[model samples]
Target: MTDRAFRNLDNLRASASTARVLNLLRVSHEHGRTDGWRAAPLFENSTLNRCLVIKHRLRRNEIDAFRVRRYVATKIILPIDGSDLRVGGRYIFVDQVGFDAMLEQALGIGPSHPDRKILALIDELPSLDPFLLREQLRRNGHAPDPCYFNVSEADLMRMSDFVASEITPLVDLSIGPDADLAAENPVARLTAKIMSNSAGEDMSALGQTLMLRPEEYEEGVFCWKGFLYYKWALQTITGDIGWVVDSVRRVKPRGRVDTEQHVAIDRAKEQVRRRILITCEATADMLRVYDDAFRGLTREGRPTAFRDFLRDAPILFARLGERLGAIQHIVSFWKYRMTGDRSAPGAEELLDLLADFETSLSGRERPDVLALAA
Candidate 1:
């Protein structure tokens, strides 16, 4: 293989999006040998191998789009079908208005409603260790790790159906069984078909995996899907709160409340916080870089690249909102505590939630540290 081939393979393996999408394909397809799919030359004085690589990149981008939808569903504590998410060029709309209305109905229906329980579990997700939850689900032989919290198997199946149905349109256009790759040039058509067929096979396999075999390789896939979500969350949290940390570091607390023990505890928390945030930020940045490459692969007439960007755009927005929300909550809480400022809505409620969340998991856990770094 040439140096270019080696570079392409190196880049492929290093990509989080590629790894997850490829693994999902691997799990779904019982047939077909993809032994050195990454290492093989993408182009060798010919168009054949280049087409293969292009198809692989396309598959990975499509999966990354779904990852964004999953994160939005999990983050908002609502059941979202694919129809709920729409992607246009550089724009995404999640039906928050409908989602909120549904949530209100669920709330009015009381805690006994099934949606109420699901929403509650999702709300509690930020407070719990995903590793622990995943392990628990694996031990219990559940379908999806995210459904480990008291959700019924039937409900899990329903969620799967909803997701499958919602994503059908994108899949049909992108990689469904009916998809074809053709061009006016004969050689181009042949090579494109080869890659397109492979991609279609993978998509069919994924449909089976999502609906029928979610438990197969559940742990790895579960962690991989959350890659973007955790990355954005941790980075934004650390970045937004850097000022607070700097203040603590620069000004030594004096007097009754600033004892030696208090100072040590505060420093320990900062150290742990820094370690977590730094690891998350690095990996998140790497994914973003790969995503940029994925976005550059489209032709002039087809705006699929921009659509892919739209799919993941909501994730970035959501992360920024989370960070700003935290900062706003903190500021308002302090203001209220010191001088009775009631202008910031939900500040007191958010502070309570944060306190509860912080108490549930320690930032210094080795598994969490390793997971974030991974």
Candidate 2:
């Protein structure tokens, strides 16, 4: 062979271990063989060794590279199916027989059992140990001898020929059947539908809502979605008060009415509290709502609005505490009422609930006041 022909042959030979070579051979014989020969010209033992070295280096330096590389090596086995063949524990087995069969079929050599011979070829590789392969290649003629040299050229030619004839036809026949089966599979259909839907043009309402420049609405939606997802994932887990507070903090008042919304929320809370005092029923539940509404208002830093309203309604806070017998919520109202020259009849009851509410709301009690109360 001329230098060019030898180079071309070398390129083709490198790919002998690749599925691409088998796939090419399976396609159009004339075109594929010519392309393989073209590829052969680019091959060199030095280049191949360098590739192997780089692969080894990447395997050592990168996480999961060794595992993935090993997996890729396993995929090189067989009818070009590109499936992983892992045997449990000590060692991984490569389907050398299947590889040889593909080569034989590619070269138009013999029939089925030739694949078994390919497996034998893997066994006969220069050295199973990668280190040994590197060292041997370095010692003798620089580069591991081509695998084809381990077996006769005539045998390889026969194997390649068999692959070209029989295996290619079989693969062609199976592709149609496999495609049909894949199309019929419910999971496959669902996957395709999902993929198609994902690719389809669709405008997001959330995106539109965000574009409206309402930061509070955007934040509320995010908080709602996050809470919904959390609740969905863990039903037993209660809502996150911190997240709710954070969401409320993001609410930017759009107009005076938005400020009034805070007032409305507080008014609703006071109304609920008033109804509880008047009716003397479900005070705890009403107080819980009132506390939540206060928290939400405080999250928006509008507690002063409620405080001003409370200043006007001193009798409400005083009477509520006296009727409820110094409950924490009632005492909290009394504590606020007494905070600035506004003493009520339940001022003494303020000590415990004031400390408790301060602890609950601010996550810390006023140490001096709490100590004095104790």
Candidate 3:
């Protein structure tokens, strides 16, 4: 974490760009994590404001060369598969005709169908909240894929261990005895194989054993993985929220703190602390839906409930992931700033940070607040 981390936080305009890029990055990475992305340009003022301004920086197939362009304010639902996250959408390529031709040739994007925008903000953040990632899928459209989403190698590194610790019990609870699986349905053997890779790799055989249709199996497996990631993420973020609550006030800002500014700061601190906890609790409460459904499947032997839970996961996951990501961006950003060796942001920047965090929750909105003398 360096001053560059919070460089955008000082100016109001840049701060908005910062927030937008961060949110887009989280949503993109969460839904489509396999590809490498670099945020070359954060904002632009081209005529094509509505579409994603995509350009290759250097070599054609170099995974790192994504640049920015300006376009009309097009709705980038994000690519479910790293190129297009949602259902079929439209893009109006309103930019340089010559370069547009080159991009069209390069990425197969025509003037009417130019590609790329989700990667513009990937570098500004470290990790994303699971809840927000899924929310983007729901809101944007169905992120159609074999696994419903993709996973990068970096993220999958620890997944094998997570599966090792949890999947055996899960299999026992959901499926019956091993003898039954071995004798009648050998495809159920994929249960053991699942622990080897958590990316839902080649699960069609497992899906067949579960009696899930092709589409159902794909969506179900993705939903299942999403929940797994959510569970993993929830544990870590719970600790993060705890840290934020405990240290929001304790983490010193760089500049002076006069009495009036102190009072405002206190108010802002209380609001952020209280809301952060409340938001985390709400996300936890939503997790109970999946919990109850799992209980029904394992304890009561009602696979229907679990199936229903999987089917309905996108909607619920979207809402839950979104709220979690918002708070997370705040807390994580704050933590990044505090842990840096350089001087902290001054009082005004601190005030803005608290104000942003205070309003970053579901169904909540607040105008920016001006800082008093410090």
Off by over 4 Å in 3: 1-148, 173-212, 362-374
Extract clashing residue pairs from model 1: 42-49, 42-50
Candidate 2: lDDT over CA atoms?
0.28
Give a tens-digit lDDT track for model 3, residues 279-330.
7776666666777776766677676777777777766655565565566566
lDDT minimum window of 10 residues, candidate 3: 365-374
Cα shift from native, residue 23, model 2 (Å):
18
Tens digits of per-residue lDDT, candidate 2, 335-361, equal 343346753322222222223223222
Q: Which candidate is the best by lDDT?
A: 3
> Per-prediction count of colliding residue pairs?
2, 29, 19
* Tens digit of per-residue lDDT, candidate 1, span 1-374: 01232223333323412211121121112222444333331112111111111111112222344323222112221112111211101111122234445434433434354434433443323222233233333334432412222222232333343333323443444544354534233233222222221223333343343342333323223332233334333444454456544532343223344355555545544653454344345435544532452334322333344333333332333233233223333333333333445333233333332342233223322222222212
The whole-model C-alpha lDDT of candidate 3 against the native structure comes to 0.48
Q: TM-scores of all models?
A: 0.28, 0.13, 0.58
Pick the TM-score winner. 3
Ranked candidates (TM-score, high to low): 3, 1, 2
